[model samples]
Target: MGYAGRHVAALLQSLGVACSGTVRNVAVAPEVIRDAEAVLCTVPPDEDGDPVLRLLMKQLRDSASLRWVGYLSSTAVYADREGGWVDEQSDADAVDETARRRLLAERQWRALARDKGIASSVFRLPGLYGRGRNALVQLAEGRARHVVKPGLVFNRLHVEDLATAVVAAMRRAEPEALYLPCDDEAAAPQAVLAYAAALGGFEMPPAVAWDDPSLSPALRRFYAGCKRIDSRGTREALQWAPRFATYREGLQDAFRG
Candidate 1:
C-alpha cells in the first residue's frame, strides 16, 4: 500500500487493525486493491509522474469496495511564501520541479476520486519526524546538520499526527478534501538541531551556511524555499489535534523513550 509498507503495517497492527501491505506492485495484484477498504499511497512522484497512479489508475477507479483513498503529499506544493503562512486554500504554484510534479499528482488523485465518487483526501505534510526518524536520532548518530538560513522557517509533523489525521479523515468520509497536517510551531532548522542536541546530551553541531560547498545538492534544494504551513482547516474538518504540537514536545518524547 506504500513505500514504508512494513512500518505502516506494524503501526496499524499495534492499533489492532488487521492490515496487509505491498511495495510498488499493487497494480499487478488487483486482488489486494480490491480487498482493501482504504488505500494510502506514500510513494513519491517520478519524472514521468506518480508511478502508483500510472500503474493502477484503472484498478483504483474500478474499486467498488474502496471507501477511502489517501495520498501523502508534501507542503512543497505551495510556492515559497518567504516564511509567511500557507493554508489548504493557498496558491500552489510551486516553482520547484519536484514540487510541481507533486502538485500534479495531488490533482490527479483528487480527480480520480471525484470520478469514482469515493471519499478521498490529500494530506500536504511537512518535514516528518517521529520515533527513530527525528532529529535526536540524527544527532545521536552524528548525522545531524545545523544548516543556517536566516529568516527561514519550516513546519514539521510527527508521524503519529499524520496517522491520527488519516484515521480521522477516513472516519469522516469526506470526499475531495485537501489538508495540511503540520505541527503548531514553525521554527528554523538550527533551532531544531540545537534543541535536539540539548535533549540528546550532545554538543550542538557548528552552524553551516546553506551555501556551504560541502552540502549536497538535494539538501541545498531543501533549504531553497521557506514557508510556514497552517493546518487549521484540517483540524476543524477532522476534529483532530496534533499530540506533539511543537518540536520541543516531540523531541522530549523521543529522548525519554
Candidate 2:
C-alpha cells in the first residue's frame, strides 16, 4: 500500500471497519475484492493503462457482494486555470500523459460500475500530505524547497480529510459521481514550505525563481500548473468538511503528530 491507502486503511480500521490491503503484486487482491462489500481503488494507471481494470476487472465484475466502488483520480485532469478555481463540473484537459491515463482509468472504473449496476465515485485529488509524508518531514530531511512564482497557487488535502471524505462517499454512494476533495485555500508552494519550516523550527530555504535553472524537470512541470481546486460542492454532497481547512492547520496537525 502507498501513503494514501495506508492512511485510509488505518482510518477505516480505527472506526472498527474490517479492512484489508494488497501490495504491488496484488496476490490476495481478487479474494479481497470478492469478499468486500465496497472497494476503493488507489492504484494508478501505467503506460499500458489501468492495472486494476486489466487484471482484476473479471473478479470485480463477478463479485456478488460488491455494491460500491471508488477510484482515486488526480485533479491534474483539469486544465491549468491560471490560479482560477476548478470544481467537479470543470471540463478535463489533461496536460500530460500520466494525467491522460488517469482520466482513462476513471472512465474505465465508472463504466464497469455502471455496467454492474453498482454505485461508483471518482475522487479527483490534489497534493496530499499527512504525518510522515508532509512538508515537515521534507524540511526535517533537508528536502524542502521554496520556489516563487507570482499568482501561482496549488491545492493540498490532508490525508485524514481524504479518508473521511471517502468514507462519507461510501455511505452515500452515487452512480458515476465525481468529486473534488481538497483544502479551502489554494496557496503558493513557497508559502506552504515556509509555514512548515516555521512550525517545525527548521530554517526556511531561500526562495528560488520558478524558472530557476537548478529546478528539476519534474519540479518545473509541477510549477507549470496554476489552479485552485474548489471542493464546496463535494462538501455539500458528502456532508463532510476538511478538519484542516488550510495548509496552516494541516501543517500544525502534522507537527503535533
Query: Which pairs clash in the backbone of model 1?
Result: none
Off by over 4 Å in 2: none
| Cα deviation of 98, candidate 2, in Å | 2.1
TM-score of every prediction relative to native: 0.92, 0.96
Tens digits of per-residue lDDT, candidate 2, 1-257, equal 68888888888899999999888766788988888988888888887668877888899999999999999999878878887889988889866887889888998899899899999999999999988889999989888888899889888999999999999999998999999999988888888888888888999988898889899988888888899987889999999999999999988888888
lDDT of each: 0.83, 0.88
Cα error, candidate 1, residue 133 (Å):
0.8
How displaced is residue 43 in candidate 1, in Å? 0.5
lDDT of 2: 0.88
The digit string of per-residue lDDT tens for model 1 on 1-257 reads 43244455666778887777666565456778877888888889887668888888778888878888888888888778887899988988787888878988888888888888888988888988878888889888999898999998999988777877887887888888888988999999899988888777889888899989899999998898899887888899999999998999999998888
